[model samples]
Target: MTELTDRYVWAAVRTVPEPQRSDLEPEIRELIEETVEAHLASGEEPSAAERAALVQLGDPERLAADYADRSLTLIGPRYYLAWMRLLKTLLATVVPIVTAVVFLAQFLGQGEVGAAIGGAVATALSVTVHVGFWTTLVFAILERAGATDAGLEWTPEGLPALPDHSRHGRLPDLVASLVFLGVLAGAVLWQQVRSVVRADDGSVIPLLDPALWSFWLPWFLALIVLEAGFAVRLYLRDWSWAAAVVNLCLALAFAVPAVLLWSEGRLLNPAFLDAVGWDPAAATGGGWTVASIITAVVVLIAAWDVVDGFLKARRASAPVPRHPVLVDH
Candidate 1:
């Protein structure tokens, strides 16, 4: 009935394997109740007795780990190295590239180098925090779930004849894709309120139509979310035919909204063209042409990504060729 008792019992039972939980939960609860009652009988205050009983149980996560026979560390030794490698790879590669891109975009759009650099630093820090947090959280969960054992067992027969590093997906690529998508989503929403591009008269020119906020932008953001999801899937599954197929579908989903917006001539602001010094007639015609070309390019890239996925999956799934052993005569 006490908060401590209820919390402790819930935490302990939740970590137990689902099949055993139904049976173990009541037993643990009974034990806790018995311990609390004994403490109270010994002249301890009711609240203090409950607290003491829960303390004797120790941390709920640790107790759950004990129940599941899992290690309580954030990442177990079995997965620690892999987690470190991935974390380092993402921080080293994706963070820098994304930071640079953000800095340049901000600088070009705002024409303030100092502000752009500061913004870039802030963006980099945010990305680093998120990447580190999510990666550790996932590994921690995997550790708690006893999933890290998949890599713990090693046999000579299981070893690759030649070290094949190319089979695995690059962590940088996945992280970059996710980060870029996030930045793009933010920029899309930002454009609705603040203009990134400006005219000489000091009038702000938004990159996207403000009217999009009512209907089209949400769909556009949805596509971005879908793309981000695919990026995560690619990271988890590596290169696979199924992943490639889904990637292609996502590409099509992205292209559809782009094409519709372009056809309707609502994707980009007309003010943006004026600010950039394009003749009105020429800019209008050219914008449509460019949009059509871009749509085509997106489709091509999607096709290529699908093909690339299948190729990588094939290479990864292929059996390593064994060389003939020559026995001494």
Candidate 2:
């Protein structure tokens, strides 16, 4: 049996750049040597004929090109991928906590610390699901674009080429981000509690003080911001969870009843208004008027949010693979 030595592939691979030639040369040499040794085991010898034959197996230039691809990594693709993962983790952690706090406050009067933590975990999972789906779609497109005839390119310094693209969050998402929502909900509850506590003191405080109206108008704006944040998340492809819950709540609380009653043709009856504390027949209309107005508002808001979100998501990005390093191979 004859043995092949480094006399060698090293001399051949030395023609390439240090990055590819350094690491890859050794591996390629090892691979070829292994193949030759296996061939020798089948009664062939490490002769010049075999060497020339192996040279024809793959061109040196092509082998070097393949090695360069292995050395090169796309900074942007890798980074966005990792960044998206982190953002998902953060969203999953934050949004659900916000939802739970507000939900428990409405249903149980207040929220406990433990419940908030637990709910945060649930929210994190929810956020992960939405972000993961869109981000995966994005990377998949990137992968398709990055595939090459030479080979897959890659680099360790990834995704920093375009920091503007890094700002993946939408304005609506910012406004209605779970953190902002939770903060707004807490502020609202605090104000309500303060009002009640002060009222218990029997002070001569005006119930709907026109003076404090200016101060409270900010709260209204804050609520609008929270809703706006919700709108952004929807635009970013978050259709389930908050998006669904918000719309469903609006429909169940207003639209469905309004539509269903109207469908039955009994929602506007005089008896219906009177029972609900409205003088239907004596006035221009009845109880149905109140429900109808509220339902219209909810439906309008929901429709607006849905449409806006879709438009924004469509604008988030298109796939482009100009990165020199990083390939889908």
Q: Give the runs in model 1 whose Cα sits over 4 Å from its true position.
A: 1-169, 198-204, 274-289, 319-329
Report model 2's TM-score to 2 decimal places.
0.23
Relative to the unseen true structure, what is the C-alpha lDDT of residue 274 in candidate 2, on a scale of 0 to 100?
35
Candidate 1 C-alpha lDDT tens digits along 162-264: 4333325367778899899999999887876677677778767788876777877888798899888888776676766677677767766777777777767
Deviation of model 1 at 259, angstroms:
2.4
Provide TM-scores for the models: 0.41, 0.23
The whole-model lDDT of each prediction reads 0.74, 0.50
Clashes of each: 0, 26
Name every residue pair that clashes in candidate 1: none
